[model samples]
Target: MRLKLAFLMSAVLAAGCGWSGADATTESGGGTIEYWLWDSGQQPGYQKCADSFAKQNPGLNVHISQYGWDVYWSKLTAGFIADTAPDVFTDHLAKFAQFVDLGVLRPLDELAPTADINDGDYQEGLAELWKGQDGKRYGSPKDWDTIAMFYNPGALRAAGFSPDDLSDLSWNPRDGGTFEKMIAHLTVDKNGVRGDEPGFDKNNVSQYGLGSDGAGGGGWGQTQWSAFAGSAGWQVTDRNPWGTRFNLDQPAFQDTLTWYFGLARKGYMPSFAEIGGNNPVGPDKQIQSGLAAIALDGSWKISTFQNLTDTSGQKLKVGIAPTPIGPSGKRASMFNGLADSVTSLSKQPDNAAKWVKFMSGEECQNIIGESGIVFPARPSGTEKAIAFNKDKRQLDVTPFTDQVKDKTTFLFPVTTNAADITALLQPRMDAVYIGESPVSSLTTVNDQLNDLFKVAQ
Candidate 1:
C-alpha cells in the first residue's frame, strides 16, 4: 500500500497528471506574460517583483498563478502536451534534463542580458549546477538551501549537553563516535531507559532522540536518506545525467543505512511506520506532538515550526546544525535546485523570456530572501536574508546557508526515468526502514534503477 502511494506521487512529480487544466492565458497584448509556480508562500514575494517589473516595463503585464506541487506538475505536463504552457515556469534540477532533452525549454543563453547571468557571482559550484546537458543554462538561480540538524534546545539541555558542544562535531561508522554518543545521550525514556542503556525498551519509549521517516518526499526528497547516500560518497549515476545507478551495493552505503536506521532499532528514533501515515506529509506526528526530540527537516520548516502552537498556542524552540560529517571526512548533503524554463510551444516567446529572466534575477531573489522563506541563490544576498530572519525565532540559520560553501554539496539525481527509479526505490526503502526487509532490497532497487538507465541508453 505504501509502495503504491509512493509510485503514484512519483508519477505526479515526474509528469504532472490528473489535475484541473491550465486555462489561464496571457493577455493578447505584447504586454502580458504568464507565470506559474508551486509555492503559495512565495506568491507574495513574486508579486513584489512583478510589480517592480510592471513599473519598469509599463506596457508589460505579469500574470501569476499558484498550484499545489502535485497539481502544478500535472497542469504543467498538460500545458506542454497542448502547447499552451506558461510563458515562464519554475523548474528543478531533478527533472530539467528531461525538459532539455525534449527541446521544450529555451536555453537562457538565447535570451537577452546573458552577460549579467554570471555563474561565478553565485555560490561556488551552484550556478554551474543548474546548467543542462545540452551545455546550455536553462535558468538563473532564485535561491539555495542545504540540510541541517534541527533540535529542541530544552531536550539537549536536559541530556546534560549544550547545543554549543555540537557546533563543530563530526560522525563516522566506527564502533562508536561523537555523533552516535550524542544520539544515545539525547535519547531518554521515563523508566531510566536510554539508547545506550542495557535494558532500553525499543517497544515502549518515552522521548525518542531523533525523529525521521525514511528518505524521499516531494518537498525535500527523502531527507535523511540522501544525506546518508552523500556521506557514503554515492552518486545516483555516472554516465549521462539521466542514467540511474544504485549505490546501495557499496559497503559505505549499507553502513550508513545501518547507522541511520539504528536510531530506530535501538529506540532512539521513531519507527518508520510511526511517522509516514496514509499520507506521508503529515506532521511527522511524533516530533510535532513533542514525543520525539530531534528530526531531520528543511529550512522552510522554520515557519511551520513557528506557527505550530500547542493546545495553549505556545511556540516550540528549534535549533539548527550543519549535517554531520561522515567517514568520508567531509560534511555532505543532497542539494536540489529548481529553474524557470520557457516552453518551446509558447506563442509569446519574447514575453516569456523576459518573465523568466526577471523572476530568476537579483531583484526577484532579493524579494524572496526578504520574506525569509528561502535563501537567495546569489551569494551577495545572504546578508539581507540573515537580517530578515535576525528578529525571527529561528536564529543562527547562517550555518545552514554556510554549508553550501562545502565542496561536497550535490544536486539531486537527474535521469530521464528518474521519476520511475525513485518510484521503484522509495517503497522498498520504506520497507527497509520498517525492518520488513533487509539489505536484499538493495538488489531489487538497483536492478530497477539500472533498467531505467538502460532504456535511456
Candidate 2:
C-alpha cells in the first residue's frame, strides 16, 4: 500500500519557517535527539520530561520543537522527502496509516521489548492502533482525546437557562429534536431576542448557539458533525483500521449532514462566511467573546477554554456537557489518540526508540497528565488527569472520560489516502456549509472518494 514520496518543493517552501521554534539542532560532538510536537500547550510539560530524561541518561539531550498543526504536518512530510525528519515526533491516528504505508515510520516491536515498554500499559486498543497493516507497531501511544460540549455559563445564565439544561439534549435527522430546540433557545439577536422567539432576526443575530474548531466541510468533521452522525447510526466506512470502502453515501450520513447544516441556515450556528473568512475567529474565541454559547471541542482544549477571560478581565466559567443523543438513542464521539513515532530516516534509530519509549512511558505521561493538558494514554495517567482537572482546575472532565468508560466511542477513520480524500471533499463540503449544495450532492463526492480508496488499494 506504500506510495513513493511525491515531494513538491513549492508546497514545502510555501509552508515557510513557521515550523521553526526553540533551537533543537544537534550541537557538534554532542548527542542531541530532535523531537517535534504540535501542541504548544504541552511544550513546557514535555520539556520538563526531556530534561528529566537527559539527567537520567547523561550526555544525551532531547531537544523539543513545536509548530502549529497544519504547518507541523507539511514540514514533517517535507522532511521525510528530504531525509531530514525528526528523530522522534508525535503522530496522529488519522495520519499514521499514510506514514506507515510510505515506509516513513520505524517498526517499534523489538525496541519496545528491549525498553521494557509494556503494550498493556496503554488504554484499551491504543497500542494496537499504532500497528501497521502489516501487523508491526510503528508508534507508542502518548495521549487520548474525546469530544464534548464546552459552554459559557455566563451566556447560558443570561438566557435564563441553567447548566443542567444541557445534560439531556437529543437530536433527529428529521427536525433536529431537542438539540435544535435548545440551540434556538440559547441563540440571541442584536435586539436581545432569543432565536426561538417569533420576532427573532436571523439576519442580525448577536450570538450563536454552538460553535467548533472547523466549519462542517472538508473530509472529516470529528469535532463538528461526527458526534451527531455517529449517534444517528452513521459510520464513515464499513470498517476501520484499514477500511477500504467509505460510507459517505449512506442515507444516515447524508441525513445527519443535512440537519447539521440546517442549523446554520436557521442562524443557530455560524455560517462558513463567518468561520472561514480572513481573520476568522475560532470556536474557543467565539465562546470567550460571548458570540457563541456552546462549542463542541476535544478534551485537549479544556485548559484553554477554562482560562478564557472576557474584555473586563473576568475569567469565563465554562461547563462541560456530553454530546446530544441522536435517533439511535445514544451519544457518541471519536475516540482518538496521539502517539510518538520514530522516523525510518533517522540515523539514530536506537536513540529515537529510547526517546519515544520514555515519552510514552509512565514518567513522561504522569507529567503531561498532571499539567491538565490532555488525558495520557496510560490508565494510571488518565486517573491523574481526571484528578488534576477536578481538584486543581475545578472542571469535571467526565463528559469526555465517560465516553471511554462507557464504550460510546468510535475510532477515527484510518485510510491511506486521507489527504487525497480530504482535498477532494473539502470544496464540496464547503459548498454544503454555505447552502449552495444539498446534502444529496455528497453522493457524487462519495463516489469520488471510493474511487480514491480503490486507487489507494
For every candidate, C-alpha RMSD to the true structure in Å: 8.9, 7.8
Cα misplacement distance, residue 80 of candidate 1 (Å): 2.1
Candidate 1: minimum summed lDDT over ten consecutive residues — where?
213-222
> Between which residue pairs do clashes occur in model 1?
16-73, 16-74, 91-339, 215-222, 216-222, 217-222, 242-415
lDDT of each residue in 344-452, candidate 1, tens digit only: 7767767777776777677877787788877777765656777777775448786577667656677666666546655777777777777888856676677776777
Error of 2 at 136 (Å): 0.8
User: lDDT at 134 for candidate 1?
Assistant: 62
Predicted candidate 2 versus true structure: per-residue lDDT over 357-411, tens digit per residue: 8888889999999998999999999999999999998889999999999888988
lDDT, candidate 1, at 320? 75
Tell me which residue pairs clash in candidate 2: none
How high is the lDDT of residue 43 in model 1?
83
Worst 10 residues of 2 by lDDT: 21-30
